[model samples]
Target chain A: MTQNPQITPEWIAVDCSATQMRATAMGAAGPLAQATGETSKDLEAALLCLIAPWLSAQTTPVIACGWDAAPFRAVPCMPADAATLVDIPTEDARISLRIAPGLSQTNPADMMCGEETVIAGALALNPDFDGVICLPGLHSRWVHVSAKEVVSFQTFLTGELFSLLSQPDDTLDGFDPTAFEAALSETLSRPEKLGAKLFSLRAEVALMGLSPRAARSGLVGLLIGTELAAAKPYWLGQPIILIGAPGQCDHYAHALRQQGITPATLDAGDCALAGLSKLRGLL
Target chain B: MTQNPQITPEWIAVDCSATQMRATAMGAAGPLAQATGETSKDLEAALLCLIAPWLSAQTTPVIACGWDAAPFRAVPCMPADAATLVDIPTEDARISLRIAPGLSQTNPADMMCGEETVIAGALALNPDFDGVICLPGLHSRWVHVSAKEVVSFQTFLTGELFSLLSQPDDTLDGFDPTAFEAALSETLSRPEKLGAKLFSLRAEVALMGLSPRAARSGLVGLLIGTELAAAKPYWLGQPIILIGAPGQCDHYAHALRQQGITPATLDAGDCALAGLSKLRGLL
Candidate 1:
């Protein structure tokens, strides 16, 4: 929304979501610079605003994941890497762009775009790694990976529901840990009462003098706890790696620890850059 | 929200909600006239706008329910009647305003404002009736009425969630029955998968080409089915009465029928008037 600073590098890696796009300028050594655009419509215009200075006449390549038009590849396949990129015709002659295809499952009808690239980077770093991978964000995914291939996955609407229920101005800064843990345990035991439990927050505020912080925390715990109940099979005993923002991963880690799972975590941005770098090697 | 039409009556009954207020004028025999205002924030002004002609020097009594400030009485109590009315001093001497208190439950921390008056009307019409009462609205309630008292009740956020997830302009006229019933059955059997099932609607649109109508129907079925799954104890083999908008009651009836229960029903507006009329008897 403000003036973007210029950054020039050999290539670029961009991860796009509905509300934001983050680009990492990549040099042979590693990430040389970064830029972010908090925008939705006219992605090309937004990207140009942030990354135009990096373009050159040498035909600089830009690899992107999470375009709305990206094809969804059926699961029981490998994570999207360089081979999955489809050439995108652009107005700029100096820009050569391609987007990595996302993944889809037919039975439960699940889809995702950027998380696959992160999974690719994780696998690239650990060639023989196999287990469950949770990429938490607006839509959190629990993916099953084996022998460098994504077997199948499920997506939970917990993050989206939390956003919808909480006040828009809320940033989860001063949430009550005690209220959160209490509500978490409550929902984990009585997941059936989720519908009723949601309304109680509003009632508690009116009748019991519940603070907004506690209510927000209770909402988070209730949603995540119910998700944990449903996703029991996914994380009950599986070796898990949570890939996301550090704060988000910490919340998930707390819940998983409650269920007796010690999950290793990787920074989502780092994995995205690593994944794109691995793809760049192929390009 | 339109030009006033003049008609005089003995007293007025009103059901006030955040979005709309419906007022009914009562005569010696039965209802005489009606007015509605689709507005909020200024309830006294909205009421006067709709019923100013009916107010006169004799000091017309206004029996109102569902005002936000109405106190909530605990359960194991009869529906709100004349005794629940709390007087409000107004600027005009012609208006004697009173609001009937709603109901609350302590353990679950639930509250209701308008539905209690509707329940009172249903009870007034059938003094000996004892069973479950379902009031379907934005925040639906299921009540356990036994021996002329509300033994306990539960509130479901299904309707609110439905409105939240649905397109603003959609009226649910063209929803797919097959998809609705199928989704209902799916959640009735496996309600734990609700968090995943919600996201599936969006995924279905992309990967499966699910029509918006079908998606909307699926959402309704999913929420209702999950609520039914949780509320099995309330409706399983128990005689039931549904009091709300006819269309909303019909939807609840359809799902109840799947569980092999047929419910007796009442129009919500009629019940609100009958309730207020019953309360007016004491005045």
Candidate 2:
């Protein structure tokens, strides 16, 4: 053999997404081997291959291996079933070595079923987050993560509303997201007096003849301000960590700063990876 | 005598837009008089001909006057020098007539230029109305009409924002307007807490995953709640008079009852017309 390799295929951390596989091999001193990330049409099989590259050649003991709730999510899982481990057989040449799939709990009946990963990742960033964490996306989430867990959360169709308002036929189709973000910052600074300013969008137009696009931005700003005022008491002195993309992070950061609250932002994908890694460490 | 008879040419009020004419006249009012409405493609000249067959060749003051700010707005006289006038013309014809052209005392740049007209119209309905008069529209004017003049007022774009937010693609596109109105009533019942409810729109959607349409209605309720709160200080134990269209009247009535304000509604169009008529009295 090649000088008798002494690498123990022990702890494995995997983040299997819809189109990608990211895996890391760890030993006693943390990350005994390197990590590999790949774009894969078949994330599960690819993940297995990444975890145990030469499973049949060696009798390495896999002490512990954990994965995020991305793979094995096609089959619906129960709420109480999240983080549960399921055994996968080795006879399947596709994977080569035996592996345990991570369980994901989702309420199929609910409007949103598979949102636990992001929330879990967001929670991992702040274990003591007792208030709301607004995750802006195509389907925005206003999660009330508290008591060291996500107790409850709500999703507003803000992203969809923004799309509609910015669509070709909508009254405010050509709104500039940059200017709107600036306006959002302006509103956050004086949240208490925002209730009166919130209604100024239309007046700024019909009365003062502001541009339709500017009106749209103003409307978005007003709504964001209203949101800050509403969630203020719940998370007053607590840290508001915005988990999203770069631009969304800046926008949300500006909003929080306006309300005298500094926001902590983390790349959503990176956060997801880190969270999975943290969970892997526990095992 | 060549029939110098009673020629009622129609006591019509014509608002000539750039491309259309909004003419309202009563039959007893004359040739241009029919009812309040808007028309394009020469409806005004047509209406004049429609009643021409009835006039008995007498010199009845057609009263073909326009209070709009367009150049040469008068039937025979044309718009005067706008720069020289004490008050500049407002974009909306009504505002031009309310505070600037007719009253001449209001600040040309201020938002509440024509607030007195609604106040006067409300006073015409309830002479003892010494407190607040809530006028709902593009720019809702909350005025203190005492001693036959507008004392002070604040403008809220509640109606416009509600319309925008409740639009088909807005946050509340498919929401039940009736239920939204009901919620508004419930919210307005406790006006003091309106500020807190303002952010519930985004929160309910983010936390509870409310529908885009439902979220829009939630925003309306929130905005109306804020409006009620802003108007509370001016309540002064006087009867609240809501001036807007039928739908607006119902919404405000529900909101007022919720706030323990017991509002008396006046038709928006009729009040507008009545306000014009009040200006007529002043003339």
Candidate 3:
């Protein structure tokens, strides 16, 4: 059957975080182009600048997601479950802008914006996949997916804390896997000591003159350790799928391997595109 | 017991933190004058300006403590146990500045500068007392004191974390004891979940429209709960004394009371003065 030109897959998927924005242009088979820019004071203007080259004469559907997206429409706690898409009014007539609603958990009162689309894509790819999917980023998500639905999830501030602590002059220079493992074990055994443990990093550097790499690795280990300890219910003996930037996924993968669990990894950008494509197919 | 005129009543006690400096003029009876200033680019100049009026024609001994104090001289782990005082050389002939050394633990590798003097003063006042002294500040310390010595100590970044999280625009309004208590209980029960629990604060505010007061109290509760869980070894069955600013002390007191403990409190400034006075007697 001949396809309708209007619905032949001219679309753009945008993830706009508080600081940065990424857009992927989708053609018939796959992504045509990918662009990123700072999410400036005017998000639309910045987003237009990034995806301007990908625009066509046809009305191209723009699906945006992230914390910076307009107020989220509460969706059911299920993976790959599409929520009502709200239209984002734009000055450009060629653009049909719409934002995907985020996921929310009422009991713990947790929420995820951009990751929901990624989760949708993952679930769509593996319909029978079960267990936890960890999306590591500024706000890391540890989501429980059972029978292709997101039952519940938790968000950790591990990435944000690490970024804040290592900003400007506090950058850690070296990488020490041993130090990271040791710190991970320490935190896992005594998670309550995390508050004191965090400060000890600074003291160690100041007094003991600890190597920058050791400090950095130890910090990552401590944060990930605490997260694992808390997310034990979600990952203990269960398969975990790691999704995020390659560097972050590698860090998580290493951390998990140290704990005797080897998690599967996926690229976050690819996942976002796949998720958006899957959603478009549903539409 | 005739007093030597040269060594008579003139003395200054200064506490120099990373951001600010406070000085008190000590007379025969009590503190005669108090001054404070920003810890500027030139610490010596800033310190001089703070205590210039209190300086005597005869070189007045200025006992200094805090993070800005000279590198600490290692001392025995005993309450009120003195360390070698390091003289801070200055251009001014009138200033005879000597900095008190802070306590350091080798095992966990922790250090404290100004709080050591307060612990000293606390020990001086209660020679027979032996217990945990909680000094709450930017870097809160839970020090175990036994037999007039600082046996060991742990430092928590609770205050610092709270300050950082509440800055710019996220200041929590009002006070909610119930919320604080609830959060404390949650964190104490599952301290490992703290990393995830922290981000939930922001999410709750965004998704659930949680009150600022509740959020503030919850943050305090979560931090203190985790601290209390780790510090159980120090304060579980032991008598506790708090030395810090009244507000911080009160918060610690309330948090402790929730755990079925009534802690005695001493003013940190007064403790510093008393500790310096006791040290002066030794000199």
Scoring only the A-chain of each prediction against the true A-chain gives TM-scores of 0.94, 0.53, 0.90
Estimate the lDDT of model 1.
0.84
**What lDDT is reached at residue A246 by model 3?**
82
Instruction: Give the lDDT ranking, best first.
Output: 1, 3, 2
For model 2 the local lDDT of residue A229 reads 49
Give, for candidate 2 chain A, the lowest lDDT window spanning 10 residues: A102-111
lDDT of 3 by residue, B185-271 (tens): 888888887888888888899988888889888988888888888888888999999998887787789989988999999988778
**Interface RMSD values, listed in order for every candidate:** 1.0, 7.5, 1.1
Strongest candidate by DockQ: 1
Model 2, span A12-121: residue lDDT tens: 54544433455545565655554456646554555555665524454443321233322433223321132544444444443322233432223211223224455556
Residue B215 displacement in candidate 3 (angstroms): 0.5
RMSD of each: 2.0, 11.1, 4.5
Which lDDT value does model 1 have at A22? 93
**Residues forming the 10-long window of minimal summed lDDT in candidate 1 chain A:** A1-10
Candidate order by decreasing TM-score: 1, 3, 2
Query: In model 1, which runs have C-alpha deviations exceeding 4 angstroms?
Result: A1-8, B1-6
